[model samples]
Target: MTGTAGSSRSILEGRGERSGRRSGGTRTLLIGLVADPGFATEIAHRLAEELPGALAERSGYRLHCRVTVVSETLSRGEGERIIDLAAQRRAREGWDFVVCLTDLPLSANQGYLVGDLSRRANAAVVSVPALDMLRPAEQARDIVVRLILEWAGELPADSGDQEIEGGGVGVRSGVQPVAPTDEDIDVEYAAPAGRLRLLVGMVRVNRPWRLVWGLRNAVAAGLASAAFGLVSSVVWQLSGAMSALRLGIATVASLAMIVLWLILNHNLWQHADRRDRVEYRQVRLYNAATMLTLVIGCGVAYVVLLAGSLATGWFVVVPQVLSAVIGHPAHVSDYLRLAWLVSSIGTIGGALGSGLESEDSVRTATYGSRERHRPPREPQHT
Candidate 1:
C-alpha cells in the first residue's frame, strides 16, 4: 500500500510539472495583411501561414495573422492615405500591425521599393508584384517579419538600421529613402524605374514560374490544332507517307503559326517608355516568358495530335483499309505517320482558335492580374 501511494505521488508531480510548462506565458501579436484582389490574395494567405510560424520561432512570441483582400487597386499616389486608413481600421479591428500588399509596380526617384512602414501607425505597404521571386509569400513574409523584428528591437546591430520621421530606428523594411513629413497624405515612398526590371531578372534566375501565364490559351490552342490536324489527315489520305524531316517541319510550322497569331493578336510585345530602361527590361522579360510558354503550349498540342492520330489509326484504320488506300500493309509506322500529319494541320487550326479568344481572356490567361488600374491621365494643358 505504501509503494502504491508513493507511485501515485510521483505521477501527480510529473503532471504538475507538465502543466506548469504548458501554462508558460507567451506574448501574442496580431497582424493584419491587406492584399489587392486576385493572385495577391493567395500570396497573402500563404504569408499568413508562414509569417506567424517564423516570427514565433525567431521572437518566441505566439503570433496570429489575418489576410484581407481588397478589390480597390492601390496606387503610389494614394499610398499614405491607404496607410492612414489601415491605421484607422487597425484601431477598430484590434490589429497590432497592418501591411497592404499590391501588384502595381511602384516607383520613387526611379528606384523600386519592396515595402513601406509607419512606426507611429504600426502599419506598412508591400508591393507583392515588385518582389522578384515566384514565391512571393515567403519573401513578403520575411520582409514583414523583419519590419516587426526591427520594431521590437530584436535584430542584430549590423542589420542596417533605419531612421524614420518619427525618430524611430527602422530595419530593412524595403521603404524608400524619402523621410515622412507633417502631412499624413503625402506619398512617402518611391521605387525607381529600373528596380522592377531588376526584380524580373531575379525572378528569371530564382523563380521562372511567376512569369508563366495564359495556360488556358495554350491548352486550347494545342487541342484545337490537334483536332484540325486529325481531320485534315483523314481528308488528305496522307497516312504513312511523311518522312522524319516532313514530320519535324510540320511540328515547327504549327508552333510558329500559333506563336505568330498570339503576337499579332495580343499586347504581348507592349513595353514601358524608351527612356525608362527598367520598365523596358520588365516588358522584355514579360515578352520572353510569354513566348517561352507559347512554344511549350504548341509543343503540347503537337504531342496530343500525334497521340490522337495513332489511337485513331489503331482502332479504325485496319490493315486491309491501309492496303486499299495506300497500296501498303498497315503497321505502327503508318499510324505514327498519320498522327504526325494530323498534328501539322492542327497547328493551323490553333491559329484560327487564337482569333476567337478575347483580349481580356488572353490577358487574364497570360498575366494573373492587369499591370495597373491607374486613373486616366488628364489632358495636358499647354
Candidate 2:
C-alpha cells in the first residue's frame, strides 16, 4: 500500500477514523490488542493499562488511543499471511487498528521477525517471542506505539532506533525488503541476536515455572529418596570424600538425566520434514525452545530439591553422628556437601519417579505441545 501512490492508507496523520477529522472533536480510537493465550495474553493485559497514555504522549495528544485486548490465537493461512486474519478481526470487532500479539516465532527473509505493519489494512502482527526476555512488556509497548505511528505517518523519519527499508517492506537492523508477493508495507526483525531472544521468549511463554507444579510427584519422590539418603552412613562418608568438581558433575548429570527423561518420556521433541528453509528453522526453534523449557523446569525442580535437602540435612543430621560415620568432625562444609550429594541422588530418583506423570501432564512444559494444541481458526479471507 505504501508503494502505491495515494493508495488506501489508514488513520491518516494519527486520526484512526477513516476520515481525517472526527466531527472536529477528539474521538476515542480503538486499538485492538489481539493476543494468543498464555504469555501473549498476559503481556496484552499489561499493555492495555499503559498503552493509552503512552499513545497520547507519543502522538502529542493528536489522537485519543483506547486499547482493547482480544485473546485469540491467530494462525497462518496460505503463503503464511496473517494480515487477512487481522483485517477480518478489525472489521468484525469495529476496531480502527489491530495489533496481533503472538508468542509464535515468526521468520522473514530467512531470519527472525519482530513484527510487520500493513498501512492499508491498519493491522499489524508482532511476534512476542522476538523481543528481549528482560522486560518484554515494555519492549512490546514501544514497538506497538512505533508501528501505529509509522502507519499513521506521524513518527519522525529520523528516529534511528528503527526505520522501514525503502520505506516499504522491511524493518531495519539486518532485515531485507519483502518480495513482490509479500503484502506487508513494512516489517521488523532482528538479525544475529534474534535467535537467542526468540528462544528465551518462547520459553517464557511456556511458563516453565509451572513445570515445578506439574512435577509434584517427581518432587515428592525426590524428597523421599533424599530423606532416606540423609540417614545412610555410606552416603555420609562418600559425600565427605567427594571433591567439589565431582559434586558439580553429579549435579549436572542429575539435571540432564531428568531433562532428557522428560523430553523422551513426554515425546516433547518436534519432528517434521519441512522442505522450506524457513519452516525447518521454525521447527528447530521449537525443538530448541522445548529443550530450554525442560532444562529450566528441571533446573527449578532441582533447586527446590537442593534447598529442601539443605534445610532437612541441617536440622535432621547430628554433627556428632555424622562425624562418627565419616571418621572426622562434621563441619558446615560437611553438611553442605551432604545436601549437594543428596540433591543430586534425589534428582536421579525423581527421573525414575517421573513415570507417575502422564504424557499430557508433562507436555505442559514443552513448546511443541503448546503449538500442537493452539487452535487455528478457519480462514475468513476473501
Candidate 3:
C-alpha cells in the first residue's frame, strides 16, 4: 500500500511538470536589444546572466531565457521584418514574455519605427537615454530583466509590500499622481515692436478680459484712421485757393494715420490673451496676412472713391448746384457720401480678413501641440 501511494504521487508530479512546459505556464523570457553597436552586445550579455536568477529568487519560478543584440542601422522596413521574425519565433517556441530595450530618442522617425515593431512583436519597449554606451547598457539590461521577470509572474504585482519592497522584482503602481513641473509651464514672449508687445503683456496680466480689450482697440484704431483721413480730404477740397498745399498736408496726415492704424491692429491681434503659448511661426504668418489685407483695404478704398466720383459727375455739376442752393460755393454732397462708403467698405473687409487669419493661426497652434519642436540640427555622428 505504501509503495502504491508513492508511485501515484510521482506520477502526478511528472504530469504537472509536463503540463507546465507544454502550455508555456513555466516562466520563460525572450529579450531583444535594439541599440547602437557599442551598447547592444553588452546589454544582451548582462541580461543573459541576470534574468534567470532574478526570476528564481523573486517568484521561486525557474526560467528559460535568451537575449539577442540587433543593430539600429537597420532600415525601417527591415526593422519591421526583424520584429515579425522574432514574433514568429516566439509563437513557434511558445515564449511566455518578450522585452525590447532601445537607446534611441522615441520621437525620432527611426525610434517610431522600432516602437511599432516592438508593439507588433508583443514586446514591452523601454527607451534608455543614450548618454554613454556602457552606462546605458547596464541600465537597459537591468530594466529589461526586471520587466521580463515581472511579466512572467515571477514578481509580485503590488510593489508596495514591505517584504518585497526593494527586491527589484516588481513594477510600481503606474497610477501615482503627477504634479506640474517647470517644464510644463511654457511662457513665450515676443519682443515689443510698436505697441503690440505692451498689449500682449497687458492681456497676459488680465487673462480672458483682454480679448474684449483687443477687439475694441483694433476697431477703434481702424475708425480713428478713417475719420482723420476723411477730415483731411474735406479740408483740402474746401480750400480751393490753397488746395495744393492743403492736399499735400492731408496726404501726409492720411499716410501717418494709416501707419498708426496698422501698428495698433497688428498689436491687438498679437496681444490677445491665449491659454497656451503663441507659436512664433504661426503668429508671423498671421501678421503677414494682416499686413497684406491692410494694403488691399487701402487700395480698394481709393478705387471706390474714384468710381463714386465718376457716377456722381461731381466735377461738372458741383459749382452750378452750389451757386443755386447755398448762394456761395459748395464742393459736392457726393464727396462726403463717397468718403463714408469707402471707409465702410475698407473697415468691413479688413475686419473679416483679420478674423479669418487669426482663426487659422489658432488652429495651427493647437494642431502642433503634440509635435516636438526640434531646433536646427547640429551635425550627428550616425
Better of 1 and 3 by lDDT: 1
- The regions of model 1 sitting more than 4 angstroms off are 1-29, 36-39, 62-95, 103-137, 156-239, 297-310, 323-329, 367-369, 372-382
| RMSD to true structure for each model, in Å | 12.8, 4.3, 23.0
Runs in model 3 with CA error above 4 Å? Answer: 1-36, 68-74, 77-96, 107-121, 130-138, 160-382
Give the higher-TM-score candidate: 1 or 2: 2
Candidate 2 overall lDDT versus native: 0.76
Local accuracy of candidate 1 as per-residue lDDT tens digits, 58-88: 5555333344444444443433456665676
Clashes of each: 14, 0, 0
How high is the lDDT of residue 199 in model 1?
A: 45
* lDDT of the candidates, in the order given: 0.56, 0.76, 0.37
List the candidates ranked by lDDT, beginning with the highest.
2, 1, 3
Candidate 3 residue lDDT tens string, 1-382: 2443354234323434432343343533445544433234455556667666655565455555555555442223322433344455455544533444433323222111112223224445543322122243444444454444433434344442222223211223111111212231111111112223222322221222223233443344445444443434442235333344554554445434553454454342443235443345334433443443334444444344335433443443445553444345555544544344434433443353334334322221211210112122343378
Model 3, residue 28: distance off in Å is 4.3
What is the TM-score (0 to 1) of candidate 2? Answer: 0.84
Lowest-lDDT window of 10 residues in candidate 3? 184-193
